[model samples]
Target: MSIQTSRRALLAAAALAAPAIWGRDAVAQIRRGDELTVGIWGGAQERITRQFCATPLERQHGVKINYVLGGTPERRARAYAERGRPSFDLLYLNIFESRQAVKDGVTMASSANVPNFANLYDIAKIGGYAVAFNPVTIVYDRRKVAAPMTSWRDFWRDDLKGKVIWPTYPGAQGTSALLMAAKVWGGSESNIDPAFTNIARLRPFAAIQGSQDQLYGMFDQDVGAASVEFGSFTRKYAETRNPNIVIADPTEGQAIATNVACITTGTRNQALAEAFVNLHLSPECQAAYAEEIYYSPTIKNVSFAPELAAKLILGEAAVNKLVDFNWDLVIANQPRWSSRFTREIAG
Candidate 1:
């Protein structure tokens, strides 16, 4: 059977077997024909979300969920623009964006309504309901680089000259890498000059990649030796496309790209929105996400097999080791950094 058919079958079986999984309170609050609009990402992410959360919620409660699909920038822009009278009931944002959203009063803060909010790990509490933790690490071609990467400084190695692909500015990979570059050279978020100065050393890049697919293509062609990338993308690509790819947790540490879901500040359907967020945080949905895309769960309730657990950032110890940044400071400096990156580095 096709993937869509299988998903439908699974939903049917789930509804039949345990409709209570959605919770009685949510079922009672949601009336037939109730509509909820959400801003979310598209493609496989959308498909899996529908299968595990949206479709199941619809079936269980007889509600209609209308999705506004695109990248985070558009959704974030809309959230801010429509703050006074927001159209979307919920939106998915990255960690920094979500924190900014809350600070700007465009998104609602955690409340008793979102009971599952209490189930998440402390690191996932970034002003919104965090869904997954994506580690930004060094990804290299194993066959090309015989020396395993153990630190962020490895990017500047002479052996990998002219083969490194840097992430373009205005992206998670780019921002994380820039900060990492700063930290490795004695500068930091508070003093970011070193990143621009240091990053210039790795000039003559193969490409300034903007998307995982672009980077993956370069890796497949043997054009890229190493680069800063998300663990989810690298691990996913390595497992599905190329075993030669390998991820390294730098000696300096790993940077996390936490993805979040939030209730719009002026949403008319607060109850429904909270219910949807709760379902998305459910162990079943979180587990499905980990299995499909390799995004580590935000909740402590979910468990994975040993192999999968090793690949994910699970438990308090692993969570605490991640290098934390002053995101407010980072976001405030983004515009200036973006310009410098273009002129000095990628230019």
Candidate 2:
């Protein structure tokens, strides 16, 4: 049978068996015509997710999807504030926010809810079920820098001083940059002193940017030469806005925080939530998402088209070059790190 047919059969069997294995209540919780609210970022990410996953699933199953779109900070804050009565059943969060969700007791355990969770990489199967990623590395105006950057340490290059942008601490890209600094500057998750010292030293040269919006006009306005940005965004920007923009894979590695989809504790339709998360991880959906949005899928086997192969993180060789951080460790020391970043790095 076809994949969709098999899925329908599985749903039919599961619904019939749930009453005996789980309870009548669990079966009733996600009956036909139910709507599953999913919290995620807005813009391209939202549109692509709908095209690749939400719309398809809604058609396959008798269900609806409601998108709760916002910034990562807003979604994270709301997930925490609502707690047991969250407005969303599914949340798409980055590695740090996913861990925070677990710590705050707002997400369901994937081991119990999502059967396909085992198919993801160990890193993807963390506090939340990682569905996608955007590998962040060096993005520069090729016209400005004669020689290509080959190391993460290139961020501190004196020749490129005052031309680089520093991400503020406590944000996704910011924390990833911190971990990058620590790794290349002789520090690790256990020791971040090197990262801080380097940040303080580079503060005078590197301008701090809170969001990508600030970096959009960097080249045209001459605010700076280049900035650390996600390869996905930079590639699209290069194609559409600035052909001068080019992404460099630091020999050290590009730091990426996996984006995950998790069922929240307050979900009234738990079964539908789990299935939606599972379907989002399917290779068909993942491939469509990767091609449409340029974010890497967490699946082990999906491949991109030839034209996209060089631009996106795909295949084993590229995947191995990814740098991951210890979110728990980052959060534990965030109080001190955030203060120092404000007083020293951005001061």
Candidate 3:
């Protein structure tokens, strides 16, 4: 079926299910002692979620929450392919995958149980499928680099050649990095030629498919001078080892690379899934997770911890500077760009 038709059907289903699960009293039909399964990313995010959301949820609702960890899109797709017998009720996806997941019937439509839906920044409500968990920022070692490394333009400098590291292409973080380059080089759209040209210039410094572990290791060892990584990573790195490490707000802008939560369409425990979605958006949950993980909170009135708040990219002013990326354009051209990058830029 077409995506619109599917969305309409899901909306209809949600409308029908709402009153049954959440009447005027706002209580779901899920009985006490029942269990709900949630699928989240395995590492840091999971730890934060369990500490902030899961344990509290179980205590409050008397429902056991089974936490499952895996690669977000792959696991969600596998659940859908199983013909609606979803192994997990909720899934965590990045922005791009959240869009595609909703289109693919992997997620249910948003419901009223998600209380902080109104608290979201406009960007967090994109296509009504997912919400932002944090804003990504540019990071550098202040002591090692004498000049202020404020923008993508700084990475292209001759002085940093063969000393920079970046994430792999086609990922949102990598795509945003490319868009940042495009913005600096005068092609902010998905034309990508200018971005590739910039990539070509930085090819000598490039490290492909590098994980956070590898990048942090490199930074610790001083093998790489700088990298464009998630704000959370930067904040944690700064807090733990390098007080000299600094996050920059570019004159051009920064992207809020996000981890979004969505309820699956085929969940056996719809109420529980919706509750989990609600928990994710709650001010308490958002604040707790933000402090623990150093990700920016999406809830409007909530404040992150002082140290984390300093690192977060909150408010309209910061959001305004971000590239209004065309996801459709990027997805359409990704293969072409990937092929060209492997041949020309990587060569």
Residues 33-145, candidate 2: write the lDDT tens digits: 88989888888767756665566556666678899888777787888888999888888887777877887798865664565666677677777788887887878887777
Superposed model 2: Cα runs more than 4 Å off: 1-29, 112-115
Ordered from best to worst lDDT, the candidate numbers read 1, 2, 3
- Order of quality (TM-score): 1, 2, 3
Worst 10 residues of 2 by lDDT: 13-22
Tens-digit per-residue lDDT, 169-282, candidate 1: 878999989999999999999999898888899988878898899999999988889988999879989999999999998878898788899898877777778777877777
Best-performing candidate as measured by lDDT: 1
Q: What TM-score against the true fold does each predicted structure earn?
A: 0.91, 0.86, 0.84
* Local accuracy of candidate 3 as per-residue lDDT tens digits, 1-347: 11122334433332232222455333445666878877778876776566545666566667788887787657757666854667767777777666666777767655455655777777777643344545555677776665888877898776677777776675656777777778788886656678888778787764653566777777777776777777777777778887777777777766756777777776667776666666566555555455556666665766544555665666676655555677767767889877886687655
Model 1 ranges off by over 4 Å: 1-29
